[model samples]
Target: MSDATLAIEPSGPKPKPIFSRRNIIVYGSLIVICLYYLVPLYVMVVTSLKGMPEIRLGNIFSPPLEITFQPWVKAWAEACTGLNCDGLSRGFWNSVRILIPSVIVSIIIASVNGYALANWRFKGANIFFTILIFGSFIPYQVMLYPIVIILREIGLYGSLTGLVIVHTIFGMPILTLLFRNYFTSVPEELFKAARIDGAGFWGIYFRIMLPMSLPIFVVAMILQVTGIWNDFLFGVVYTKPDTYPMTVQLNNIVNSVQGVKEYNVNMAATIITGLVPLTVYFISGKLFVRGIAAGAVKG
Candidate 1:
C-alpha cells in the first residue's frame, strides 16, 4: 500500500486546536460578564462602609475616610420600616421561618418525583413530565393571582404557611427537572441490580439513589436558599407586614421617599438583607460548582 493511502486510511479528520481564537473570545467575554456582575457587589460594599456625609459627596467609587460599623449596627437593630423602629433582625427571623420548612418539603417532593419519573414506566409518566417541563417555562407572575386566590380560599393567606407553600410550589418545577436529569445520569444497572436483590422501590431509592444524590441535593439547597432568601415580591404580597421577610423591609427602608434618605442606612440595610445568600454562596461556591459539574455529567 502507498504511504499516503496508509496514513490517511483510518481515524477520521484530525481535531482542531483546543485554544483557538474562538476559545479566547469565549473566555474573554466570560471575564467581562463576571466583572459586570461583580461591580454591584463592589458598590454595595463601599456604600455600606461609608457614612451618609460621604455618600452625599457622590463619589460612589471613593473609599470612606471613616469606616464605621455604625450603619451595620443600625441596620441590624434600629432601622425603621414604617412606624416600626425595629431593624431587619425581625424580618431575618421571619425569612428563616419561611425558608427552612419550604426547602425541606420542596427537596423531598422533587427528589421522590424525579426518582419515580426516572425509574418507573408507569402510565402517563412522559405526559406528566412534559407538563412539568412546560410549567417551568411559564413566568411565575402569571400564576400569582390564581395562587393568591387559592391560598385565600384555603385560609392560608397572609400566613407563614402560605409563603412556604408558595415557595415550594413555585420552586417545584425546576427542582424536579434538576433531580430527574441527575437521576437519569445514574447507572440503570445499579437500579436493576437492587431490584434483582429483592429491593422494593423505596428501598432502592433510599438505599442507593439518595446517598448518591448528595451533590445534587447540595446544589438544590443552594438554589432554594438563594431564591427564598432574596425573595421580595412574594414576601410582600403573600405575607402580612408583621411577617415580612428582610427583603421587604429592606425595600421599604430604601424606597421610602418622604423622609431624609439616609443613604448609609439604606446601603447598610441592603447589604444586611443580601448577606445571608451571599454568605451561603461564598461558603458553598466550590461545592456548588462541583455538584453542578457532577450532576451535569450524569444528567
Candidate 2:
C-alpha cells in the first residue's frame, strides 16, 4: 500500500488560460493608454456635435446632451472666417491638392535616396548622408529664412509647387535613413540574383526591391502623409494665404478674431481637418506596425 501510494499521479494542472494576471495587467495597461490617447478625440467629437449653448453650459469632456450635425454642416459649408464664408471646404481641397503631390514626391525621393545609400555605396555617399541626417536635427526655424530666400530667388516662393518641394527636401533625411537601414536589413542574396539576371540599378530597384519592400513603403507613406498633412510651419511659410494647407487654414478659422467665437463650428472644422490623417493611420494600422518593427530590425 505504501509502494502504491509512492507512485505519484501525473496531473499537471491545466496550462494557464489566456487571461492570467500578466494578461490582465497588459490588457489593462493597454486599455488605459488607449483611453488616454482617445480622450481628446472623444472630447472633440462631443463638442462638435453640440450646439453653442450646450458648449457654454457643459464641460468639454461631457458628452453632448443632444447631438446635432448642424455644426458639421456649418463648418463644412457656411461657417465664416472673416469675409470668407465658404467654410473649411476651400482649405480642405487645397490640402488635398497639396497632400497628394507632397506625399508622392517626398516618398519617391526618400525611397530612392535610401535605396541608393543602402546599396550603391558610392564614394562619399555616407559622408553626404551623414550631413543629411545631421541636417535633420537642425531646427527648421534656423533654415526657414534661407528657404524663403531660396524659394523667392527660384520663383517658387508662396506657391504650392514650392511647398511640395519644401516637403520633399525636409522629408529626405529621415526617409532616406529609413529606406537605407531597411534595405541594409534585406538579404543580399536577392540583390545578387537580380544582378546575375542582368538587372541594372533602376531595374533591380524596380524589379526586386520595390515589390519586396512594401511594408517599408507603407511605413514611409504613413510617415510622409501624416507629417506633410499636418505640417503648419512649412505650409504657412511657403504658401500664399489662399494656398494655405488645411492645417494652416484650420488654425486661421479657429483663432481668427473677426467675430464671436463659435466653439462648435471650430471643433467641427478640427475634426474634419484631422479625418484624412486619421483615416490613413487607421487603414494602415497593421502595415504601420509591421513597418516599424521591420525598420528597427535593420537600423
Candidate 3:
C-alpha cells in the first residue's frame, strides 16, 4: 500500500472530554442539587454561630462575620422552655434513653417476627403478616387514637415505657420487612441442613443466620437510631412533658411562646437535635449500601 494509504485516519469521532458539554451539564445539575440540599445545613451552622442582632441584620445564608459559641452553650444548657430552663441537655438524655430501649426492643421483636415469617410459614401467618404490612401504610393520625386508648388501658399512655412500646410497635413493620428480606436471601440449604442437624427455630437463628446477617442488622440499627432519635410526634403524643424526647423538647424550646424567639439558639438546638441521626448516617454510610442490597440478588 502507498504510504498515504497506510496512514490511519482517526476513528469516527473525537472522544468527548470528561468536562465537555454533556458532562458539564450533568455535573452542573448534580452540583446544584447538592448545594440545594446543603444550603439548609449551611444556613443552620451560620445562624447558630451568629448573634440575634446579626441574625436580624444579616441574611441567613451569610457566614458569621463575628462567630460566637454562645448559641451552642445556650442551646446545650441555658435556653428555656416554659418553667424548665435547663436547656436541651435533659431532652438530649431523655432521647438517649428512649433511643436505646426503643431500638433494642424493636430490633428483637422484628428479628423474631421476621424469622418466623420467612421460615415458619404457618397457615394464618401470611394473613397476619399481610395485615401487619398494610398497617404500616396507615397514617399515624388514623391510628393515633386507637394507640392512645390501648396505651391508656395498659397504664402506659404517658410513660417512657409506653413511649418505648409505641416506638417498637410502629417500628416493627419496616424492621421486619428488612430482616425478612435479608433472611429470605439466605440459602435454603443452610437452613435445611441446620434443621436436619436438629437445630430449632431459635437455634437456627442464633447460630446460622445471625452471623451472616450483620450488614442487615447494622442497616436496621441505623434505621431505628435515626427514626427513634428524630421522632417528635410519637414522643409528644405518647409521653408526658417529663419524658419528652429531644425533638419534642426542641420544639418546646424554639416555639414555646414564653419569650422572644432567639433564632441563634433555635438554630443551635436544631443542629444539636439533628446530630445523633447525622452521626449514625456518617458512621454507617458504607455499610448502608450493603444492607439495602440484602435481598435484591435473591429476589
Q: Tell me each candidate's TM-score.
A: 0.86, 0.89, 0.92
Q: Is candidate 1 or candidate 2 better by TM-score?
A: 2
Off by over 4 Å in 3: 1-14, 296-299
In candidate 3, residue 107 scores what lDDT? 95
- What lDDT would each prediction earn against the true structure? 0.88, 0.87, 0.88
Model 1: CA > 4 A from native: 1-35, 295-299
lDDT of 1 by residue, 52-120 (tens): 888889999887888988888998889888878889888999999999999999999999999999988
For candidate 2, the 10 contiguous residues with the lowest summed lDDT are 1-10
Q: What TM-score quantifies how close candidate 1 is to the native fold?
A: 0.86
Residue pairs that clash (backbone atoms under 3 angstroms), model 2:
none
lDDT of 3 by residue, 100-186 (tens): 999999998899888888888888988988988997898989988899999999888988888888899899998998888788888
1 or 3: which has the higher TM-score? Answer: 3
Q: State in Å the error of residue 237, model 2.
A: 1.4
lDDT of 2 by residue, 22-111 (tens): 999999999999999999888888999998998888698888899999999988888765567788898888888888898888888888
Global fold similarity of model 2 (TM-score): 0.89
